[model samples]
Every structure is written in C-alpha cells, then in structure tokens.
Target: MSTADNNSQYDKFPEVAIAGRYHEAWQGWPQVVAALQEALAAQPRQKTVLVVECYHGVAQQELLKALILPLRPAALFDAADARRSTAEIEALIAGDLTDDPVFGRRSSLPLAAFFDPAKCAQMQQAIAAVSHGLVVVAGTGAALMADGDLLVYADLARWEIQQRFRRGELGNYGADNARADLLSRYKRAFFIDWRVLDRHKVPLLQRADFLLDTHQAGSPRLVSGAALHAGLRQVARQPFRVVPFFDPGVWGGQWMKHQFDLDPAAANYAWCFDCVPEENSLLMRFGDVRVEIPALDLVLLYPQPLLGDAAYARFGAEFPIRFDLLDTVGGQNLSLQVHPTLPYIRQQFGMAYTQDESYYLLAAEPDAGVCLGVKTGTRPDEMMAALAQAAQGEGRFDDARFINRFPARRHDHFLIPAGTVHCAGAGSVVLEISATPYLFTFKLWDWGRLGLDGRPRPLHLHHGGNVIDWQRDTDWVTRELVNRVEPVAAGPGWQEERTGLHPSQFIETRRHWFSVPVLHHTDGRVNVLNLIEGEEAVVESPSGSFAPFVVHFAETFIIPAAVGAYRIRPCGRSLGQRLGTLKAWVREEETPC
Candidate 1:
C-alpha cells in the first residue's frame, strides 16, 4: 500500500518508505535464519562468530530459544554473564537513581561501567577457542568480546520496554531486580540504563551487519544495517509521524477511544503519546515487512538534518518539543500539578530545561474549563494549608477559593510556563504542546482518588510549593496566559495568528486558518504541527524535495529542518473546506544552547 493510504488519524501503525522505496527485509524466523545462514556460508572454512548486541529490555532468553539449535554453534557465550553483580550495580547508581517518585539525576556512567573487565576478557578468550562451527556471543554487551563474523543488533523500542517493566518482565541492565516498583524501574532506566545503551548503540548502529526488530516476542524482523541508516536519513528529509502509543490512566476519558479508534476494552485512554520521540518508535516499510526502530535513533544519528541547524546546535540530539493528547472528557479532573522552574529542574533532576507547556483545546463540552494559577488575593500559606489538608482527605480542595477556572472554548490556547500551576479540568480534550522534559511534573493534589494501581497517586507538596510562581495569580494569568492571540499575517484565502506560549517559555506557537494552500518555512528549525480542525490535509514540498504527506485531523506530523519549505491545504474529504493547524517551534533567540 502507498504511504498515503495509511495516513488516517485512526491508523495505529503508520509506515513510511526508506530512501524513496521499500527496501528488502526478512520477516519471521525462517526468513531471518535463511538470510543469516547465507551470510555465514560465504565465510567458507573459518570459524564464524555471531555477536548479538541487544538493548537492555530485549529478551535474550527468547532469542536463545529461537537461534540456539538452528545455528548449532560449537560454543555459546552470553555477554550478560559478564555483568557486574547486583550489589555492585546498585552501589554504582545509587546517587543517580534517587528515591524521588518522578525524578532522578541523569547518570554519566559509560557502558563499560556495567560489565566486569575480567569476565568480558574471559568471554573474548572463549570466542577465540571455538575452532569450528558458528560461535554465538550474545547479550547486550556482546560487542565488547570481538569483531564478529556477523553483528546483529536486536533492538527494542522504549515504549515496549516500559510495557515490559509494567508487566514485571524486565529490569535494569546488570541489575536482576525484575520485580522492582514500576516507577523505580522507569527511574533507573531513564537515569542509567538508557543512557549507557544509547552510548553503546550509536557505534553498533554504525557498524552492525544486520538490524533486528525484536519488538514482538516470536515475530522478529531483520534488515541490513546500511538500509537502516539510509531509511533514517530519508526520514530526516521529509515530514513523518512516529508510531503513537496510548495508555489508560485514572483520569482518562472516552475521547481518544472514539476519535482515534483505540481499543474499546481499555478502561480509559488518558494519554496518546503522539509525538514523543524519546518513548515512541518509527516503522519503516520494506515490502510486506515492517521493521521498527526507536525514533530517537533518527535524532541521535542525524540530528542536524532531522532537527535543523539552530535546533541541533542548541539541543544537540534531543527533540526539544513534544505533542500529546490529554483526554479528560467524561472523566474526573486531572491532578492539580506544578512543574519545576529551570533552575530547580537543573539542580534537582539534572535536566537542562523545565517542562514549560501550553494547552490548545481540541474539543470542549458545554461546561469545559481549566484550573490555572492562584486567585489574586490568595495567600500562600492559606492555599498550602488547604492543599495539605485536602491531600490528607480532610476535604476536597476548594478550587473556587484559591484557583482561577477559565471557561475553555475550542481552539483556545492557554499558556502554562514552568512554575505556573495548572491542569485541564473534566469535559475537555486537550492537545498538550510542551518542551520534552515530560516527567518533571510535581503533583500537589490528585482529587482524593487512587491510581490505576489501586494506590494513591504520589504527591510532591514540598516540591510543588518550592517551584510554584506566586506571582502568576488570576490578574496576571488573565492578562498574559489566557488566549493571548494576535493576528500576524493574512493572504487571499488564509490567515495566521500567534497563539502564544508565554515569553518566558522557549516554544512559540502559531495557528493557521486556511481555505487555500498555506506556505510554511522551517527557517533552520524543526516544526511540529497537528490538524486541529479538519478531516484531512496534504503537506507538499514546494521544490518536490520529498513525497507529499497526508495527515488527518488530530494527527501530529513533524517537518524536519532539512525540508526547508512546504505547503499545506485541505485535501480528500476536506477539500476546499476551512482548516486549522497549530504549529510550534523553538524560538531562536530565547532557546538556550
């Protein structure tokens, strides 16, 4: 099928071409085995060694069960055997993986820190001893053994890793504690495991002979490493969408379930991580086979082309902006929350920036509203005491007493710079546009409800109090944060408005209402956009630099800085109809390098 055929907003699995065409890829075990066997056969009489270096959450045991007898290697060396003892790893990462519920210090440990030198040397010596047949040296750090006859990278997506963590099926690398708390596992992975793995993955992705998609347990996909790189480079030159993952939460609602055609069996769809590259994956279609790789690979391997000149120089390998859906329609209010200030986030969590964000209302019921900032005359001590008592179940937090609840309308944009307390109330579907420091939220109240895990959700009253900006009261918020829209430019059939993010935040948002094709330029920075009001629209390169991309309503697409210029207009069912798109980009002067 053509790439445009799957551009529907309800498409859960979106696939794109690699280098303008679907290259060859092997699907299932037999096809993968045939390809590897042919490669091994070309080596003639020499002892062939196969090295399978995996990401931390990959199932090594499953790979062994699938490849052990088929390859029939004379000897096998599992690289995990060389990992440091559990106690050693704990002591090593204790400082980085703190007890904080939603935060951790970023770790600087290298991949070499997780392995024992003597054990690795022993594994290398063992590889040398195998004189005949295939010698398989497998596991996450297997590449340290020796240059192999065939290097296969068994990669796992970060979202899949999180699911495995929630299911108690995985643990931090070199630490055999699979049954740790879900938040603890995520903390360690964020602070330590993923950091070291990415450092190791870059070199391997550059040199691996084959790339394997082991996302599913038994169904594995394989492709050449060069083809993988070519595909990533191709993606950097065009507009595309990452594979979005949805999850149920205590405050989830039915909006996404109906709008995105999500699984109806799920309790409620609270979040659709539509454009979070760090936790989402990309699918490259090669004929009938689809190979999945972490979206961050594109960021790491080709940050300049994918993220643009100024953005790459400023954020390095990070995708600075994120777009997600927060559904509170037909559900309870979201937890009253506050994000850390820049200095607080840097000193407390080792992050470079705070999660300064804005909410653009997608759909709102008759009574839809948002709780933002404190009242003009509210006292800090008075509000804190009420929140403390409410958090302890003494009474429900009195929103009317201290907070300003603004009536929300469709397309209304609310600026929420870091340190300003805010949350979307029930009866609204919010398109949350923000910086990428996603997990830094410090919740002060949770509406006296237990989490999906049947336990009370965590509260960070002390942290929230420390970071809350007392000056963002109702008077200031109404004057500055609420619906700060201004007409910027217009054409024969289109108009553009600057729908802010606050001046203190680095992200700048613009909304376009177009009935005819509207031109947009990347101007040396990446642009993230969504069709907020339309059935479908097509994004075309003015110079025919890449193929025309189609996006449906509520679907977010990224325009790489490399694209230079593109145009968008209503298409398919929405042709000639008025459409609206919300676009965000990093402000040139304000973005911290």
Candidate 2:
C-alpha cells in the first residue's frame, strides 16, 4: 500500500541497528524455519514440547503452515480450541465493550478470563499424553495450554491489527465480528482485547526463547529473546523513531499524501501516528530485513531508561506524550470537540489523566482557522440547548454566532486544555501534541456532515455539556492559548522558545530554530520532537555515545532520557538553512498555574 515510501526520506520503515553481537535475528521463511529446527534439535529431551504463543492478530494458520512441514510434529494443539465459545466470550466482555460508537468502559479483565477452565485442563492433558517427537502448541494463549521446553512469542503491532480491521481480515479475540462496525471493533480492542493481551504478553517478553515477527506474509523474522532484549537495551540509549503508520479518515486530506510521499492511490491521509508508542511499531534492522515489534515493548521493558526515572515513577510504564497529525488540508472541518476533564475521565473512563492537547499548525491554507471556545458572552445553557437542537437536525448550530474563530497559519500554536471547545478548520494540517489518553474527546458537532458510513456521526452533547468551560471564551482564549511563545535561551545561530501547552497541561513544549548545532539535554525525561521546518537535521551525542541520527522535515523522533546530552544541527539540504523542531517532554517539576 505504501510502496512509494521507499523513495521518500521520511523513512516510513525507520530501523534501529542492533549491535553485531546481538544481531542473531534470522530473516525469511527459509532462514526462520531452519533456525527454529536448529533450536528444537539442540534441546536435550526425548520428547519436546514447543509452545509458539502469538499475540492477538497474528496469522495463526500461516505460522502453522510454515512450521508443520519443517518440524513435522507428531501432535499439535491450537490454543483457540481452549478459549471460551464465541458467544460466551462476546457475552463476557459486553459491559466493557459498550454500545457507544467510540467509547467503552475500561476493562479489568485478564487473559485468563477469556479461557474456559475445563478446556484449558483438557488441552494440558492432551499435551501431557504426547511423549515422543515434537508436540507443538501454538496460537494466542498458547502458554496456557502447556509449558514448553522452548517457548517462542510471536508479536504483531496494534497499527497492523487496525489495518486488518479496515480490510475485514481480522476480528477481536475469540469473537466473530470482523464485519461489524469499524469503530465498535476498535472500541473492543482498545478497551478489552489489548488491555488483557498486553497483561499476558508483558511477562512473556522476558522469558520467551525467541521473538517472532510475522508482519509479512510467508516471511518471518526470528530473534533470540536475549538478542531481542539486548537490541531493546540499545534502543533505550539512543535517538530512534517508532515505525509510523498513516490512515485515511472521514476528515482526511491530501497534504500528507504529497508531503510525506504517502500512497497516492489512497483516498487521503488523515493521521500519521508519529510517536504514539501505544499503537506504533519499532523496527530493528537485521541483515536486509526489518523486524517489527510493538513500541510499547520498549516502554514496558526498559521504562527506567526509556522514560527516565522521574517519568517512570509518574506514568508507570505508560508513554505520557503523544504526537500525531490531523490532516484537513483539502477536506472538511474536524468535528467540534472537547476532551473530558481529568476528574471526569478518572471517574468515568478509569484513565489516569485526560488529553490536554495543542495544535501546532504544521501547514495551513490562507483561509485556515480554528474554532476555539465560545463567544465572549455566550452562556452555557443557551449553547447546550442549541447543540441539542442541532443534534436532532433542527437546524445548523450557527457556529459563527457562538464559536470564536481564530485565524491559523503555519507555525501557529493553539493550546487546548481539556474542556476547551476546539477543532481545526478545513485546509489545516495539524501536529497534535497531547497527553496519551487520546480517546476521551467528545464530539459535539460535525458541520452536519455524514460519516463515512453514510450516517450522521454520533454526538455526545450531554458529555460535552458537562465538561465545556464556558469561561474559556473569546477573551480568555486570546490571552492564554494562542501562540503564547516566550524566549527561553539562545546561542549563536540558534534560538529557543517556550511554547504554551497551558500550565494545566503536564506536557511542556519547546520550539527551536537553528542554522548550526544546538545543544539539548533530555533532563532525565524522554523527549519527543518533530522537525516542523526545513529539510533535514542530524542529532549527535556530544561524547559519541550513539551514532549520529538524521531527522527529516516533519518526522518525529524520540530521545530516551538516558541519552543525556545531545546536539542537533541542520544537515543535508538544510545544511545552511534555519530548521525548526517542536519538542515535548513530561514536566517533572511543578509550576504555579
């Protein structure tokens, strides 16, 4: 789908190099199959039990085909056979996977909840009976079937799973709802499947004999667990990028297709999941192949070094900052929305915090602007009533009468603390920097447009009304949220400025422009940055701890807290040009609001 990405410097499949000593990863079905055979042969046992546990969304049938011919196991068991029936599993998670189009109650269900005790016991007995040759137990929850002499974990990225959802090729675990509403499937995965599966996979990352990447069909990469862990350790000590994924949306536009060299055949590119660790992937280079793994693995495995000691203590293995693009450059306006407040999210959604976002206008047309807050004197009750009427198709919401519009241009920053009514107008490509709890946004309006499903999108007027801050009117927004930049520090050929994310937001943003090398310190917290301007720049360590890394225009990169001191300077096409980068990090120290 993204064949053109190869020609683009964006490096759609960015890869981090593993040290040569730990580059034991084997590529392709031929090499991967041989490696598995060698490992099993080396095991000192008359009868060997090989458990190949897959993360949900992996191609189970394909994996079995790849192994059945080579290993010629005497017996095999699919963990799926041990799961509860489809109807039973559906009933089990119905409460957490609610009827809401885009939201679901957070689930506390563990992986074991999806398995039937009797079925699991039966599978174990079957495994115990196989006393000779190779006995293979493979599939999601395979480890529950039996403890194997050598266990391998096959992992797939969340973004790839989302693509499978769009393509109607995969469904929720133990559920047959692939053709159901796209949003509902995503809701289930986000609220239940991923949560439970992640709980199951975290512990396995440490002890699995091998890590398998089956991202490509008929081709897989296998890395010894020790080598994989060593590679992750290397990643935690340098600058790297999560493998980005782009998707088309109802409000998607053409800017990304042209700017990022995206698939021209796609309708439009709406979002680029730049540095969102939750769903993005990490690529480790081995020989000529790039093996994909979830970026969350790095955060969960090396939280102290990847997130820094302070951020690890606060977020607890959660990646607190997120960066993505909202492209409306040649499309319709985004739904007028407001994210829930912290207190409301905590009590209602079981999230630790809410999304406090800022829009850095990466690119905008001449007429681009944003709808922010309400008119200076607008009353909450009156606006709510009008929104209620609009929901019922009474008439238009008369946004001009109640919503304050601010002209947005390239490089403009708009701070959106939770509860502020805002949406980027048409013709703007937004770099949305926010806290990681991203789905709490409640859409109150959509310009009366139909969703891609040919129905009016669901409205959350009641939820929006409860959280809307009427006091965040035209005057307050003008004073506090619009391009609130202050000079911080400067050096020859470089200048640094603090950009407003609002004091209430825990993520702090900084903008830097330079024509020469500019020094930076991670300050013991992970740093996420986007090259918002110019062509390219190189990030280097002062003491050469890691190799110099190059970042291109609009690509986001991360500096693990352990990276310590680093420097970035204009390079390639921008060697003598002034380039700009927008940087964000968790604010460990508090300041007066």
Instruction: List TM-score per model, in order.
Output: 0.96, 0.96
lDDT by residue (tens digit), candidate 2, 458-546 = 88987899898889998899999999999999989999999978999999999999999999999899999999998889999999999
Give the local distance difference test score of model 1: 0.89
Error of 2 at 301 (Å): 1.3
**Top candidate when judged by lDDT against the true structure:** 2
Question: Worst lDDT window (10 residues) for model 1?
Answer: 1-10
What is the Å distance of residue 174 in model 2 from its true position?
1.4
Clashes of each: 0, 0
Our tally of clashes for model 1 stands at 0
